[model samples]
Target: MPRERELILGGQRSGKSRRAEQRAADWLALDPAHRAVLIATATAHDEEMRERIARHRADRAQRVPGLVTVEEAVRLGPALARHSEPGTLVLIDCLTLWLTNLLMPAESGSASPALAETAHAGLLHALHGARGPVLLVSNEIGLGVIPMGREARAFVDALGRLNQAVAGACDRVTLMAAGLPLRLKEPG
Candidate 1:
């Protein structure tokens, strides 16, 4: 794989995470010395979510046995910095979940707006300074009608802005629909 930063955006079940995993798997297949690390940003807040995470883990392991997994719900900047290396591919499985962990914490009084901003900035900086290739997966939830609740609206807006920022930072951006990828930005 080329040394580039790529972002994948899609709706739920639109195959964003699957595309990122495929890229990581392809990168790992290139050489024995190559390494791939998946930064999982999902946090289990309920039983169903916990089970979903477990299922994803099992599926990913079967798909990419060589890809190492690192569970990091918050502090993604630090996680990316620590794992990014010259011969390594760093894949973030989803950015919206990371944003949720920031803006809408399951436990109240854990994160503030300023904290979220700082984390967001830190992630951008880490991306700019990464020594290896990176693939980021994120949701594109703004394609439908506006949300009803205030919190839902806020989350939607936040994710939209976050996606724009990451897309600008990446060398390539792709939108997935029905398991097919449409290239939005090509690396120059």
Candidate 2:
């Protein structure tokens, strides 16, 4: 399947995306023919998010000049499958937002429960079957206080399960905090 798969877990502003970008840049630097593509899962619903995405776009462009990007929110499995090439590195900016989209869709009744389950399975299958390298970024939000709302609690639990499954599928797993990485798992 994948040449290498890495899962980067962290909180907000914890440098997970930066590390993924750096990995992409390094991969591109290794060979002239090497390529990198970032699949962004975020949808800018508000002005603040729009600015944040724009800032990330500009910063990533400056940091990794040879990198390309593709925006995919729900259909990430097919997108990943399309981008996974032997000479390329595919990076998924964040899985948290993707989960949110599938679970609590912004468009009310757009995403059904069965659809979310199918999409989640598809994503894991794609990761396992990738031909090139894959870098996944996800938030670690279960460490904080318990949320009062049932929906909030369900989201946290779902994310935890999703993270666990992704981590198990990955070749390496790292926890990021204060821009530092603590390696959790690595292939021997």
TM-score of 1: 0.97
- Looking at model 1, the pairs that clash are none
Candidate 1 residue lDDT tens string, 1-188? 55699999999999989999999889988988999999999999899999999999999999999999999998999999999989999999889999999988987846466888899999999999999999999999999999999888988988898899999999999999999999999988
- Tens digits of per-residue lDDT, candidate 2, 28-146, equal 99999999999999998889999999999999999999999999989999999999989999999899999998988887855466777798899999999999999999999999999
| Positional deviation of residue 128's Cα in model 1 after best superposition, in angstroms | 0.2
Please estimate how well model 2 matches the true structure, expressed as its whole-model Cα lDDT.
0.92
Measured against the true structure, the TM-scores of the candidates, in listed sequence, are 0.97, 0.96
Q: Which stretches of candidate 2 lie over 4 Å from their true place?
A: 109-111
Lowest lDDT block of 10, candidate 2: 108-117
**Backbone clashes in each candidate structure, one number apiece?**
0, 0
Please give the lDDT score at residue 78 for candidate 2: 98
